[model samples]
Target: MLLKQLSMSAILLYSSSAKSLDCAGLFKDAPTLVQGLKPFVAEIHPANVTFVPVGNPAYPDPVPDLPEFCRFGAEYNTSSTSKFRFEAWLPKSDHWNAFWFKVVLHLFELKIGNGGAAGGVDYREMAIPLAKYGFAVASTDTGHNG
Candidate 1:
């Protein structure tokens, strides 16, 4: 199915088994999270840093004052001629609350975001603020280049 057809639940179903996701151990544990999913084609490698620093030249739109967080990305081979890609930012577990949902009193908050564009997944600007405030966020390219 194309990315446009997938519901948020369907996208998250692939990673439901990851009870606790942390950046420090992601380099070693990320593969297991994406394992056993059909059409899966993620080749996760060991990253040298726990988090990308502010103003790093590596990103296309670097946020100057964004807080450090763990960045994760993957691509799934949806078909012989197409691929779907996405990126997720997790607040460093040690630095802030990392839960996707919080239940305190009668209120619930889910901080995930679909901050992207039709041209590409551009979550950097949106993800930074949420990550700074202790929430995980994500965005997708809808299966194409920027």
Candidate 2:
């Protein structure tokens, strides 16, 4: 029983980590990316996904040197009239700084909190630089419309 449980754990870990992660491919292939996380996240459905390449000025505003990253947004439909949307930014798979990866051994995940009435995952200021360092950044509007 112990050995069986360990095997299952190993399988889960391996399956969750993308072997060939791609910025654009994530939009069509693995939109949600969240699995085994039920009740709270099972209802998540991809609503908007956009991948912006480096040097392209885009929505909200423009960052001087923002790296190419995947922008994903989803809605959690809890009821007929109750649904909230959130967004996430995943850095390029090549590991922005391969040298840093060789020393750090792993990437990092950063979560930004809602600020005042912003009501959106639009923290590009912080998200962009972290993404350049290969950090996975995520933020939510927290059900507000700002």
Candidate 3:
């Protein structure tokens, strides 16, 4: 049984690695795909115009010389009134690694809270390190935004 499980794991890993997609190449070659995403892309103020202080206690220190990325939000609808929202950060061609990292945070302690509103300030902070490593990261608010 153990050997079988190991073999299955190896197969899955190999298949995933073999089929990795080059996101930057896809976007560049497919103009229609970029056009379709127009509605979902969020407009971000340039970092130079909207600066967060270095010593702010409420937020994590901003990443210095951060790579350029496209920020976008999407909704998944299961019903007229029920929907889920998520945000994605796609690093530009210069930094893209054709890999994705989804961020999931959970705190079991009673007093600490869930660490601020979902997809709020905390999510962006959490993505910095992953972005530095060239990952395309996505974060969801579970279903509702705070």
Taking the tens digit of each residue's C-alpha lDDT, what string does model 3 give over 61-118? 4544545555544444435665444445555545666565555344431111224454
Off by more than 4 A, model 1: 1-24, 36-59, 99-117
In TM-score terms, candidate 2 sits at 0.50
Least lDDT summed over 10 consecutive residues: which range in candidate 2?
Answer: 98-107
Q: Which ten residues in a row have the lowest lDDT in candidate 3?
A: 3-12
Which residue pairs in model 3 clash with each other? none
For model 1, residues 1-110, the per-residue Cα lDDT tens digits are 33322422333343333454444354444445454223222222222332332322223553344445545555565667876655555554444453442211112244
TM-score of each prediction: 0.52, 0.50, 0.48
What are the lDDT figures for the candidates, one per model? 0.43, 0.39, 0.42
Instruction: Output the number of the lDDT-best candidate.
Output: 1
The residue-by-residue lDDT of candidate 2 on 1-146, one tens digit each, is 22222322332232236564343444443333343211122111122233232321222553344555445444454446654444444444564332111111113422333445555445554444445466544444444532
How are the candidates ranked when ordered by lDDT, highest leading? 1, 3, 2
Query: Mind sharing the TM-score for model 1?
Result: 0.52
- Superposed by TM-score, candidate 3 places the C-alpha of residue 93 at a distance from the truth, in angstroms, of 1.5
